[model samples]
Target: MLAKIEELLEQAKLAIDSATSVEVLYEAKVKFLGKQGSFSHLLKEMGKLTPDDRKTIGKRANEVRDILEGKYAVRENLLKDQELNSQLEAQKIDVTLPGVAPERGVLHPLWRVTKEMCEIFSRLGFSVRTGPHIEKDFYNFDALNIPPDHASRDLQDTFYINDGVDRKPGDFSPWLLRTHTSPVQIRSMLTEKPPLRIVSPGGVYRSDSDMSHAPHFHQVEGLLIDQDVSMADLKGTLGFFAREFFGSEVEVRLRPSYFPFVEPGAELDASCPFCKSKGCGMCKGSGWIELGGCGMVHPLVFKQVEMEYPKWNGFAFGMGVDRMAVVKYGVSHIGLLTENDLRFLGQFRP
Candidate 1:
């Protein structure tokens, strides 16, 4: 029985050493140490022997079993280490290879135009200002002289959040995503005294989306408040913008237009760069391209903010940054600016 136990131990040790993988080593271990295995069979046979012989056989069998278990554990761990090392060698990273070039990203068209517009205003002594996208109806509409059921309020086509504040259905309060940056004009007027000249640039939302319109777009609204601001000043300011933006040679004109927020408002136009007033596909046979809207601040707007001092007056102008960028960059569709197509966007190097 002692010789048999010794033989089994030698066979198991040989198999453990010769085994190419941990799986094979585990199977070999089970053959010797399992419940219906060699060691267990040896112990069962021990009961047939004399009590003294049984003690000798049982002790030898247990010793061999314990030794085999300990060796199997060591072999399994060593096999694991061997596999890890082999994987490490196979999947080695070559540090000597040339580094991949980091991809460069260009500014989005709207942002580019916004930056350019800000720079243009900055040159004219106007500081850049920003305000929240979410705003009260008073600042967005009422303070801008837009009445409750007026065309401008409906014209905004706004997006309002449901805060569950007590109000009738369809009777939304001041809370809404700002449809325009004109609200910043009220914010500025309320907070700061006159001689305020600022260009507010930010995201504005409307419940509108199409080929040329996005639900969320950008606008740079310029305000110049001081004594004796007029329509001519507004025209002059916008003309400067057009000239600086397009070229010193570009001509600008203002056609009479209306906004409920701005009394006697007009849409500014600039000659098409491509056709140069000779009529082209860009201009649709008209020499001019509609750029933006500008007008003197309405008296009701100042009254809404409770600015009683009549000496302060101003001209406010708003131009869609995306629209200007489209015209400037010769982008045919507004969707291209928002669409993150690598092939389409990669063309705008600057």
Candidate 2:
């Protein structure tokens, strides 16, 4: 029985050494040490031997089992270390690779041009002022010297929220999206006493859309109210703006035009920056670009705001911010400004 136990220990040692994994090593342990195993079978046969011989065989079997268990524990730890090293090698990352850069965002072209225009005016003692997009009929039209019967007040031109109907007389002014930033001028005048120098810039809505126009657009309106303001001051102010904005050499000209709120309203034009006023496709061979409208504030406009006309007269001018952006950046379409396509907007990045 002792000889048989020595042989079993040798076989268990060989099995444990050849095991590639902990699972295989465990099966080898069970083969020798388990109830139906060689070692257990040999112990059961010890009853046939003398009592002294049985005691000697049991002691030898216990020593063999302890030796085999130690061998298995050492082999199991070695296999586990190898497995962990292989897993870590598979997951290792290279530290020297260049990192991916994140994308950056920029302002829309319309807003860029709006800021530029406001900054130019801001440098000239004109403080910025803003008003609500939703406006009352009195401030938008009546206070701006635009009569109810005016063509601009028609449903075809303006967008009305309440349509000024079905209300008790003098209940409240009907609401509508403002047609121009001129309403902001009226708002500022009604609230504050002048000498006021302000430039109003904001979104305006109208029932209009085309290659050059949009249903929703932006405008910057300028107002200067004080004693003895004149058309010359308006022209000089606009002229300086044209030279500074377009180029140092660009010239300005105002063609005689009519508007409801100005005594001598004129269409403001600047020499084409592209052609240097030498005639081109951009200016349609005229060498001039129509910018916007400017004129002296009308007497009735002052009356509506309850300011004395000749005593507190001023000049007001308005220009389309979208149009300015189109002209400055040479954008093909006004509608491109409204479309949120990153491809189109990416070109205007500063």
Q: lDDT of all predictions, in order shown?
A: 0.85, 0.88
lDDT of 2 at 19: 95
- Model 2: per-residue lDDT, tens digit, 1-350? 67778888889899999999878878987888778877888888888999899788888878898998899889999989988999999999988989887877899998998888989998889999999999988888888888777888887788888664687743433688999999889989999999999999999999987766688999988999999999899999999888878889888899889999998899999999999989987788999999999999999899888997787889999999988888898877778889899999988767
- lDDT by residue for model 1 (133-163), tens: 8898888887877789875456358888778
Assess candidate 1 and give its TM-score to the true structure. 0.71
Off by over 4 Å in 2: 1-64, 86-95, 163-173, 278-281
TM-score of each: 0.71, 0.83
Lowest lDDT block of 10, candidate 2: 164-173
- Residue-level error in angstroms, candidate 2, position 197: 1.0
Clashing pairs in 1: 137-174
Most TM-score-accurate candidate = 2
Best by lDDT: 2
**TM-score of candidate 2 to 2 decimals:** 0.83
CA-only RMSD, every prediction = 6.8, 3.7
Please, what's the RMSD in Å of model 1? 6.8
Model 1 lDDT vs. the true structure? 0.85
Worst 10 residues of 1 by lDDT: 150-159
